[model samples]
Target: MSDVEIICDKSFSDVDSEILDRFVEFQQAIIDKDEAKLDEILTEKYELVHMSGKRQTKQEFISEIMDGTLNYYKSEIIDPTILWDDKERATLVADVALTAKVYGINGKWTLDTTVDFEKVDGKWYFTKWDN
Candidate 1:
């Protein structure tokens, strides 16, 4: 993620910064197609809800990206906002511009996304992505 540019609209607290770092890493994993890193970052029950209302389990989503059904070339996170439900749960909302190919369609799209994270045993893991 050293090559990626992440622009923040406002200053963040220490907790928020940590979450943002994890979020950036997750985006980097997708671009690099790093399955191991993805697994480490995402929870076991991770799910992704697509813009088309399609739902995919963790494995299914990873498989699609691996098989090129969903290909991610680049990503840029802009002005992310984090809302904490409690000390253990939070959601990050942002407009992510992604250059990719999805289900045969290729383009750069700005997606309004909400990513859920939960703290377990002092570590934050992504639980879901609602796009």
Candidate 2:
């Protein structure tokens, strides 16, 4: 696999490292097609919103990944910003340029993505991915 360029804002702190790491792992899981890992990292109510406003539940997204309906070759995450809504809830916003095949279409697509996370039991889980 080729390298993925990830650029983040300078505002992140040591307290934010766990969230950042989990977010990166989530991206890598998509490229690696690691369904089990994705399942582990996502909340039970996780939803993935596409650029067109279509929403897919966690299971639906993982199914597509497993079947090759959604294939991620690589990604470059640019200017990621983190915003904490509370001590346990946070949002990560970024522009992600993705090289992939989606629903039989293949190309590099740049998307503005906002991912929400919630910390529970001292662990973070992805709650929503809006693009």
Highest TM-score: give the candidate number: 1
Going through the candidates in order, what is the number of backbone clashes in each? 0, 0
Question: Candidate 1 on 17-124: residue-level lDDT in tens?
Answer: 889989989888888888999889889899999999999999999989888898888888899999999999999999988888999999988889999999999989
What is the per-residue lDDT of model 2 for residues 1-131, given as tens digits with 9 covering 90 to 100? 53466876476687677887788888889999998999999988999999988899999999999999999988888888888999999998889999999999999999998999999999989999999
Report lDDT (CA) for all predictions. 0.90, 0.89
Report lDDT (Cα) of residue 3, candidate 1: 35
TM-score of model 2 relative to the true fold?
0.93
Worst 10-residue lDDT window for candidate 1 reads: 1-10
